[model samples]
Target: MLIDLHVHSDNSPCSCMSVAEILAEARSMGLDGVCVTDHDSLAVLAQIEEGFQPDGLLLLVGMEYSTPQGDYLVYGDVRSLPSGMDAYGLFSAIKERDCAVVAAHPFRAWRPSDIACVTCENVAAIEVRNGRNSLRDDRLAEKHAAINGLPRVAGSDAHCIHELGCFPTRFTVPVTSSSDLVRALKNGQCEPGEAFPLAVGL
Candidate 1:
C-alpha cells in the first residue's frame, strides 16, 4: 500500500500545515495512511482524539527529532533523546529504549554524521528517498543501504501537502498499524517508489 512514513503539521517549526490541513490533504491525495511525525512533538495525537475523520487514512503518531548528528525519525512512545548527544550516544540511547530509529536524509553531504556511523545495527533503516534530498544524497543513501545490510526506506519529510508524496515509500505488506509499518521497514518488505501514483497522471 502507499504509506507516507514522514510528515509534519504546522506544529513543527518548518511546517505550515495545520493538523486539519494534513488530514484533508491526505484525503485528497488518495493515500492509504500517513505518519504525522512533527518535529519533537506529539501534539498531533490530540488531533486524532478530537476526531480527524479517519476516512480510512491511518494517521500514525510519531515525532521527528533533531539530534546533534542529524535528523532522527522515531516511532512509538518515548521521551525526547535530549539534544547535544553525538550520533553514537543517540544510537546507544535508542537501542536502550528499543525505539525504531531511522536516519533521515542520511546521505546529505553537509551533515555531521557519515555513512559509517549509520551502519550500526541500532539504526532500523537508512532513508533513501527523502523528498528534500538532492541527487547526490540519493546515490549515497542507496549505496550505503546496500553496504550496511540496512533496509532502504523513503520519506517525503513533508511539511506541506505538495511535499507529501514527492518521494514516498511503497510497502507490499498491508499497513495495519505502527508495528506493521516498522516490520515493513526492517524486513525490506517495502521498496523505493516514484513520487506519486503513476496511473493517476495518465
Candidate 2:
C-alpha cells in the first residue's frame, strides 16, 4: 500500500543502514516496498537486489546524482551515468534509456535556475517531501511539481533505519514487477502520503 520512492542505505557515503535493517524497518513501518537510492553509486543495488526475493520486501534499485542542477533521483538505467557527470549532462546521457529521473528536493536550494537545463524528456516527477528538508522546503517542492505538471513524490531519503517511512510515498501500483511500479508512477497513478519534514543543511 505504501512505497517509498527515495531511500539510501549503507552503500551511500552518508548512510549506515544494512539491508537487513532496511527490510526489518520496512516491515515495522508497514511499507510494501522501498527504492534503495544510493548516492553516486549503483554497486550496492546489485547486492541489495540479490537477496530481496527471500526477504519478501520489494526493493527498487536507483541512484542519486549531484548534478550542476542539484540532486536527482534516477531509476531504470544505470549504465549511462558515470560518477562526476554534471546533473544536466547526466540527463542528456540517460535520455535515450528512458530512465525515471525525478527532481530531488527541487526547491531545497531556492535555485531552479541551476537545473533549468534539465529537460523533461527524462524527468519523471518532483520530490515533494524529502526527509532531509524542512516544512517550508517541502511546500516549495509541492509548488514546483504543480508548476511543472509532474506528479509529486515523497521519500525519507533515509540513510538510517529510523528514517524509513518518515516521508514515505504511496504508489497506486499493484504488486508486480518493478517496471510496473515505474509505469504506475509515470501515469500519475501514485501519490505521496505521510510527510515528516526535516531541516538539512539549511
- TM-score each candidate: 0.84, 0.84
Which digits, one per residue and each the tens of the lDDT, describe model 1 over residues 24-50?
777577677788888777777666742
Question: Which pairs clash (backbone N, Cα, C closer than 3 Å) in model 1?
Answer: none
Root-mean-square deviation of Cα positions for candidate 1 versus the true structure, in angstroms = 3.3
Model 1 misplacement above 4 A = 50-53, 79-85, 96-98, 109-113, 197-202
C-alpha-based local distance difference test score of model 2: 0.70
Name the candidate that leads on lDDT. 1
Local distance difference test, candidate 1: 0.72
Ten contiguous residues minimizing lDDT sum, candidate 2: 110-119
The per-residue C-alpha lDDT of model 2 at residue 119 equals 36
